[model samples]
Target: MKRTVLLLVLLMAAGTASAQVPSPSQPPTPPPMPTPRGEVLYSCPGGIDFASTFSNDGELATLRMPGQPDIELSRAPSGSGFAYSDSYYELRGRGREATLTAAGRSMRCHAAGRPGEPPRTYAGGTLTVTLFPDGTFRLRDRREGAAEPVLDVGQWAQEVEGGVRMVLRGIDNSRRAFRELSVDKLVADDGTELRRTEKTDPIDGKFRLAGMYRDAQDGGLFTACLVGRTYGVAPGGAEPELEKAWVEATPSREASLYVEIIGGFDNNNSITVDRFLTLKRDGACPALVFRGSALRDTEWRLVELDGTRPTFTEWRRRPLMRLDDAGRFTASTGCNTLAGDFVLDPDGLRFVPGPMTLMACPPTEAEIEKSFVEALTAVRTAQISGTTLDLIDATGKRRMRLEARGR
Candidate 1:
């Protein structure tokens, strides 16, 4: 009887505990997966490339490619395609094959390469070979103009797109005598045989010079473009010294090229060609950046010297200096007129004032003019920023400050 009573009490207690417990709740649903989106680089098997971000579903936006501006693209009215003006792009075969003509030329392209794909990253992939009629060729970074060629030389080719030559005369006077680089023997100073592009763009019909470049050893770069068949090179930081230099390019790829050079140099005038490549292309050409002389045609009036304001007793005049492209300087001190011969270069400025007028003047004014001429001779360098120019020495110490007139 006691055992039966205990069992009944335990069952009652279990039932009460079960009733007090709360029921379990269902798990929250996970957020829907983000729409698949990625960057797509559309290319003409061998011609040009266009980049865009796409929503795998259908839409593509931000088409950035060379030879054209950034074009915004949307899904086509019918199937999997996009359009901009007369340029219609039909991306099929999962982006492996497509047709687009925004580059002003219709092209049927394939996935040449992607941004992160090791084979198609910057400075990688199929080497672009540009040949010249003179049996010369350049290894370009890309297909179009504006890319500075990595290497340019007159070549004796063992093989090319089906042609052979010992020496070339692409231009009437284009070849350099006694210099022939075997197509196979071309290499960097450290000697690395460059590889060619693994695949060619289907639209890669011709190559042009358009791009920016710099030598790994140099401090800056230059922008090269062929503006209207006129090849040009514009420097970035310090101006370059160009002598007996001109570039020549052709309308046909591997047919003719603008053969010129953009490389690294130092104070001693030695060239080290390294890290030279091109990318920014314009209309298949280059623009020349030839800064003949900085001081030429520049006119200035002294504002302050050695931190003292101009002070003259009776007859006073503000010192004026004008330099012409021919390396001649004409100046007038507050009291006297002076002429001089001078040289201005990356080195330093040296003014050798020649004969001066001996016109008499007030004692204070004469003293001012004498010291003014002396200051001009001390200019070793110049710090020109817009309208203000500070003449500095080798130590970068400011000696005279002048203001540009009528800039």
Candidate 2:
């Protein structure tokens, strides 16, 4: 009788548990969906229109073009507005304006639509620009005959807070080189011109130069890479910090360092280093940086060979080496052109010389060319940093140094 009573109590407890549980028709709640970020279509030079999709945090932009791969650019530092960059491209924008620097080409772009902004005419300095709400623009050269308007139709975008930038598209990309206009003045449709009330700042007569600085016996000598000119430093004209910076940048005596300074040229064509702006330990020229050349498929000119500087020749026809993705390379030996194959593995890099041209050259040129070819064969590894490519021998010594000059 007691065992039966215990069995009935256990059955009653199981029935109470089943009643307390929720029904099968009720399901658990799910998470909320993420809100979508906006997208913008931009019209660029050469009729290249692209679309940029932004992330929710505004830290990433994915660019999409018709025939090209999608590029993901991360947010980079900018003085105003936004900037994004990857290894190959740089995109900058403010308001509805965007500009892309890719493949050694700069193209200005504007977003497709602006709802509140209507078609406005801006005229200044014999040029008239009409910007429409659809982001298309028409620019006319008023300097010519009044009977005909030389129209340049393309895209327009907001450059800054109060400025609008218009880019001209050329037929066959002829006039597309650096052809842009920034209009700050507004001309009403009724022909009334509106100018800014604020006075512009006066221009400063100072100039800035950045290049390699060598502490020579006479004084400090600088080679401006962009202009490819050498200038002597004015004695006692530099700030005390400039000397300190040079000493800090150079680890040993007779070392060449990179420096940037601001000054004006004196009567003797020497620059006075009035202000020291920057000092990098080993920095490449700004020209090469702006060229945007990568390691592979880039033509690199031999600047230093076997711990000696190469003789100056024709600037454009200097000895260069080009490495392709197919493990093949072609190089100019200052006398003969050589074609070769190379190997790149995790262990190191090696070059195997193949066919070469046998050209008669002067004694000095022939000797230099012979040494260059031998140096290539001796290269055991390669190192690339910034705009420089250094070839090293088995002894870990740098045998040759090259700078990226593009194709």
Candidate 3:
């Protein structure tokens, strides 16, 4: 009975102990955990950005930020350091060492180099950061000496598309102020932007002033004018000039009755035979006077030849009649010479003559000689109307119609 009572008491005590202790098979409920503070949402080839509500320890803190400029940090002899975010910025330096923690990592950096230490510099340094449950992060720089911020933190942003627009204002060395431009657009493999097309402005304009027309048969000077000005005359002559003299044909004249002067200075000076001569069948040829620098005071007679042939034979040995592809005519007047090109048209013929050589001849002969040459070189075209030959010069300056010399 004593042993039973003892065993029961022990059992009751064990049961009470067992009731006090939790069952080993059952797991205890855990307390609620705090949310992580900081995170690295995005990064690019040049930069990265981390956001956290961390306390700023007395030491300088550096962080990589997107779209931000690079940062730099340096140490001074006063056991102090300077940090900059962009080009040349100076930051406050404290003697305390700095630590940074972000993205589940941490780094520590000292203010200055140690004794007997080789000089060391860092372009980019490893970064470590720790995030507390309270949305706070501890950032550390794991370099021997102070370092610059990975980039300018001022321009950091989470979602930057179409990018931030930056306006740079400054004066040039010449004191000329201008605005700088920055454009952001997608580019193709050829380096051309997808948005830009075709040039906006024009390239050039038209050609002007082709040439002047001169009648080959008559000494008519004609020029196509675009500027409302006459050409082929004495430069200072009448502003608005008329077309050069022209020629027409009359009945009973041969179509090749024009004269043209050749072999002169630019054909400026030449002689011409008037086409108005009437052809007479008499054995004696009609006489015409050619007065110019090349001509002497003499009369030349035209001899009627048999078989419709025209020839010149006298003191001066030369051809009396010359025929060109256009039926315009040229002949030696026994002096300065005569030549012309002519144009034959339905209405009439245009004649252009060359200028006469300024050689001084007898006054009476001078006028005739110059006039004859001027009449010839200007001939533009020739035609036959009835028995008459009409000659027109290139410029339509001069015109002549000749009747049949021999009836």
The stretch of ten residues in a row with the least summed lDDT in candidate 2 is 27-36
Looking at model 2, residue 269 earns an lDDT score of: 50
What lDDT would candidate 3 get against the real structure?
0.25
RMSD for each of the candidates = 32.2, 32.5, 57.7
lDDT of each: 0.40, 0.57, 0.25
Model 1, 112-230: lDDT tens per residue? 22222222101223343433321123333443564544333222121111111122212222332211133232333233334333443222222322333322222322222321111
Worst 10 residues of 1 by lDDT: 156-165
Model 3: per-residue Cα lDDT at residue 363: 49
lDDT of 3 by residue, 139-212 (tens): 22345664642211001111111121111111110111111111112232233332211331111111122212
Error of 1 at 229 (Å): 20
Clashes of 1: 41
TM-score of 2: 0.31
Residue 15, model 2: Cα distance from true site in angstroms: 86
Which residue pairs overlap in candidate 2's backbone? none
Candidate order by lDDT, decreasing, is 2, 1, 3
Error of 2 at 58 (Å): 31
Error of 2 at 164 (Å): 44
